[model samples]
Target chain A: EPEVTQTPSHQVTQMGQEVILRCVPISNHLYFYWYRQILGQKVEFLVSFYNNEISEKSEIFDDQFSVERPDGSNFTLKIRSTKLEDSAMYFCASTSTGGDYGYTFGSGTRLTVV
Target chain B: KDQVFQPSTVASSEGAVVEIFCNHSVSNAYNFFWYLHFPGCAPRLLVKGSKPSQQGRYNMTYERFSSSLLILQVREADAAVYYCACGAAGNKLTFGGGTRVLVKP
Candidate 1:
């Protein structure tokens, strides 16, 4: 089956640097999202993208965070300034819609900030 | 506060079948969800929203499918640990810390 794909499964960056996590959602899906999970925590929603704009975003996604569909196939999350707390597993997901229908998630991109 | 409480915290770094047990005190029930997560990996959606005791036996037409209550029959591929979760009336899904299941060789 066709699944959502992400690039650079693991990444390590120095604190205060920038990091970009990328994802390619299922082709037919219409909604996109980003979530994070600390090593010992449940996954938390970061932001939801729709109609080429962000429809929803969590508090964790503050001034340092930004997302864009730079092109038709790539959805990206950019962290302007990485912090120790920013270290976590970032996952990308897509769904036809979010109400009743389900979502498909990518294997995830591990972001490590030193 | 309103949140997703996943219990049974961390387990072995390798193969595990996490139970991902959860419950809710919400006066009005809405939806349920389950997701699997690997160490240093992203959380994957394994099961979607379900009503209390409403998830039917997992009957699969494909031989590779499972048919038990919440992943009824288990397999090695199903060995990624499991979690049980519930979504509130809103789209928020509160996850159980999850149960870790290991498959011995």
Candidate 2:
């Protein structure tokens, strides 16, 4: 089965540093999303992208955070300035068609801010 | 508030049967999705049900107020954290806290 791929399985960075997480969604997928989960917590939606523009974003996605579909296949999330609270597992997902069809999630990037 | 609820953990023997439930409060929810996640991994879709009837080891039933995921048979490989998510008209998903299952051999 085709899969979404996320780079940097694990990353450690200073609290004030900038970090970029990359994801390559399925070739045919039209929608991409970024989600995060703090340890032992429920998954939280960050942002959703479609047609090269942000479709929806949660309050957690603030000025420090930005997402871009740099190319047709690559979607990225950049944190301008990281905070200790930013440490979490970030997931990337894609769906060929939304609604009843479930989205496929990548393995995730474990971001640890010191 | 709209939310999904699931047990924190469940334990069973290797060959025992287990049912993991995901109940939700989203009144506009049109579909319920079940996902499996191993430790240190991302969530993987197991099944999705838009209506009360669907096929596969995982099945779902939707009511006016909630939904559920029913796993009929269990195996060692089935031991993983399971999450129940509800998707509304916009394709946004609200996930539960997830239930951690441990299957002892």
Chain A accuracy as TM-score for every candidate: 0.97, 0.98
Per-chain TM-score (chain B), model 1 = 0.52
> Per-residue alpha-carbon lDDT of model 1 for B50-88, expressed as tens digits?
433333333211111111124443455555655554543
Best prediction by TM-score = 2
Best of the candidates, lDDT: 2
Q: Is the docking of candidate 2 incorrect, acceptable, medium or high quality?
A: medium
Query: lDDT of each model, Cα atoms only?
Result: 0.66, 0.86
lDDT tens per residue, model 1, A1-114: 778898889999999999999999988887898988888676677988888989888889999999999988899999999999999989888877663545677988889899
Docking class of 1: acceptable
Off by over 4 Å in 1: B9-20, B25-29, B38-44, B51-77, B88-92, B102-105
The DockQ values of the predictions, listed in order, are 0.35, 0.72
lDDT for each residue of candidate 2 in B21-76, tens digit (9 for 90 to 100): 77788668868888989976768887776677545777677765566666667788
lDDT of 2 by residue, A24-92 (tens): 999999989999999979999899998899999999999999999887889999999999999999999
RMSD versus native structure for model 1: 6.0
